[model samples]
Target: MSGAVWDAGRCWRCEADDVPVIWLGPVQTQEHGAGPFAACEPCIRRLEQLVETHHMQADRSA
Candidate 1:
């Protein structure tokens, strides 16, 4: 999640509208309009946890 921002809009991850959102990276799916994808706080935290877990696994493997 690069260049993330806290805002109020639809969360691309959970599809929850009228809530707080953080704009992040590009929207890979064609279903979305343009880039600068939006995600809620919970989603961001989950993603951060996933990334941390992945890094830990990679470090152990290395």
Candidate 2:
């Protein structure tokens, strides 16, 4: 995992390459054209947190 990929497999947030990369494919994976995605553990956590916070805010606003 540490040496997974040097270029595109980095953390989308912190630019880290010392952990396993997880794909963040589109929800509609069967679409005509799908792309690849990668994220490290910490970046994943941060992204999850932001999503949760955003959803909570949306709910409160509604």
Candidate 3:
């Protein structure tokens, strides 16, 4: 599903028309287990920021 065209209207991030949204989920690898989740670009960035902040806080506490 890499080259599949996603409808922009279904995106939870941008309101732009025909924005190519991708489904990033079910990241099951041999090393890591599977999880139920998906994200758009904006949401992915937000999650990254949140994780960074959480790690920073933990580091400061330690």
Candidate 4:
């Protein structure tokens, strides 16, 4: 699906342009469920931060 074009106007987290939306595919886990939504650059960053926090918490617990 590389080089696929996404609908820029549907993106909510960032200004829609030529940039591809992040996390606009199926969810990685069953708990999260499936997703076809689009996210912008800042949202992607926020998601990364959230994942990092979760990982850190997991490590601390371990």
Q: Using lDDT as the measure, name the better of candidate 3 and candidate 4.
A: 4
Residue pairs of candidate 3 with colliding backbone atoms:
none
Candidate 4 lDDT over 6-61, as tens digits, reads 45544555556666565456544578766566676667778779989999999999
Among these predictions, the greatest lDDT belongs to 1
Model 4 Cα shift for residue 53 (angstroms): 0.4
Worst 10 residues of 2 by lDDT: 1-10
Cα-lDDT of candidate 1? 0.85
Residues forming the 10-long window of minimal summed lDDT in candidate 4: 4-13
Per-candidate count of clashing residue pairs (backbone under 3 Å): 0, 0, 0, 0
In the order shown, the candidates' Cα RMSDs to the true structure are: 3.3, 6.7, 7.9, 5.8
Ordered from best to worst lDDT, the candidate numbers read: 1, 2, 4, 3
Which residue pairs collide, candidate 4?
none
Candidate 1, residues 1-62, lDDT tens digits: the string is 56656799998889999999987777766677767788899988998899899999999999
Residue runs of model 2 more than 4 Å from their true location after superposition: 1-8, 26-35
lDDT of 1 at 32: 70
TM-score quality measure for candidate 2: 0.58
TM-score of 4: 0.53
Q: List residue ranges in candidate 4 displaced over 4 A.
A: 1-9, 12-19, 27-33
